[model samples]
Target: MTFEQLSDMIAVVENDTFLEAAETLNISQSTLSKKIIKLERELNVKLFDRSKRKASLTEAGRIFYEEACRLNQDYFEMLTRLKPYQGNRRQRLCIGTLPILTQYNLTARLKLFTEQNTWIDFSFEETEEAQLLVGLRQKKYDYIIARENLFSKLGCVSVPLAEDELMAVLPENHRLCSCSSVKLTDLYDEKFILMNAYTSIHQLCIQILKDAGITPEIVRTGRVESIISGVAVGEGISLLAKSNFRIFQAGQVKVVPLDPPTKLSVVLAKLAGTAQTDAMRIFADYMCNGCEV
Candidate 1:
């Protein structure tokens, strides 16, 4: 099978809709269908079960699609390595981080590395912890900065950057605002704006509460800003990392440090066996040293 066929199959599996995949590839739906059929015939395996309303990959198809994706990623990395040798002096550093950290001057922090070395180019992505780990393993990102707990099984090296304490965010006039520090016990009955289960921070929060023998009354679940906004509108109070307090405008939300404070450790992670380029080394040093912008 040709790389074109592999790409078409990967697209179909990713979009799960022939028409949508075709649209993304800028090809006609009929052509996309022909490509998939040809690929399946060559492989002697059904790539997708087309009988269903929404196309779904068969078990074998799922495995094949994963390999195809890896092949594509490897091809891109090969091209990237060769491209720089052709006088492309701009070195690219891709970083994946959590949304909360991205909101709190992460770009500005990286600016120090770029400004000092004009030949280096930087790109940043903010995504959930699972996606970040996946990208890290796939070598899509040069490095990642996320909750310290996420890198344990990803076979990456990590360096602790900061410790973020969970704080209770409430309205300025809320009764809880009168307290100097609120404990997990204090929030047991309070309506909480929480993060979704897929987020590492959310899972960490749940484990902390469970360990403390407190079951929170979850009123809503979403991203950090959503939780903070919910608190601002009096929907519910939320527990967030102290580093995230800068995301809210002054006077919009009141952030109270938690009693018996729990902290999420932040770390910078890189692939275990990958050799760091000079630019990568400099960037890592800047982050660890807390280089000023």
Candidate 2:
């Protein structure tokens, strides 16, 4: 019925399985299944054969899909032809980002870009890494600024923007605060206050601990601000990027570098095969040229 449902159905047929389609669309399998079911109910005809191991399209589905594909192509072509007629209108560029843009010092660059490019209107949505990918795939965002590890295997074009090291964040009075650096083993038995599981930092923390054969007793998980406040109040220690220390109140927490630094790479990513608009191409070049990390 809708463009999204049509696209989802098309993905299942092209990929030959609901699971593959879900992955390709950056949605859960159950969500994809529900969409297809809802779409079938609307049309009052089964789109896929349930008995097949693969997603086999029914006769009705084949007819619908062929027309859908043609319609989609015509729709895009119409938009392309109309682009030249919209004179002097501000172009819209929607961006998806992680919550740590300020910490990474990328906000200043973005602001400057906006100032110089008066003809482009920018919209930013901050969410978890997982949601960023989903938004990009769903065409909800033109681009996403996230950690490189997230889209490395997802066939996205990534331009590295910045880098920072993960460190130990603790209350000013904590015993380890006096040390220049702390090892992962030193905090093995200590209570940890980490960011939510949906964040890249949370996964990094868990992986580092696991690699070192340590089981962290994580007492709390929350947003960046909540975790920082918890650590300040001595709720528990936490691991965070070094650049993040600038955001917290001075003298409230002590941030010491990890013994062997763990680096985080933040990149500007977009769907690999998407056609680059003039605005997109210019912004990409500007950001890549201006960034040092």
For this target, which candidate reaches the highest lDDT against the unseen true structure? 2
lDDT of 1 by residue, 93-145 (tens): 89998775554466767776666666567788988778888898888999998
Residue-level lDDT for 217 in candidate 1: 77
TM-score of each: 0.62, 0.65
After superposition, the stretches of candidate 2 with alpha carbons farther than 4 Å from their true spots are: 1-91
Identify the candidate with maximal TM-score.
Answer: 2
Clashes of each: 0, 2
The residue-by-residue lDDT of candidate 2 on 116-202, one tens digit each, is: 766677788998788888899898888898887777678898888888888899899988889989999888778999978877788
lDDT for model 2: 0.83
Q: Which ten residues in a row have the lowest lDDT in candidate 2?
A: 77-86
User: Which regions in candidate 1 have their CA more than 4 angstroms from the true location?
Assistant: 1-92, 101-103, 250-253, 291-293
Candidate 1 residue 171 Cα shift, in angstroms, is 3.7
- Residue 237 displacement in candidate 1 (angstroms): 1.9
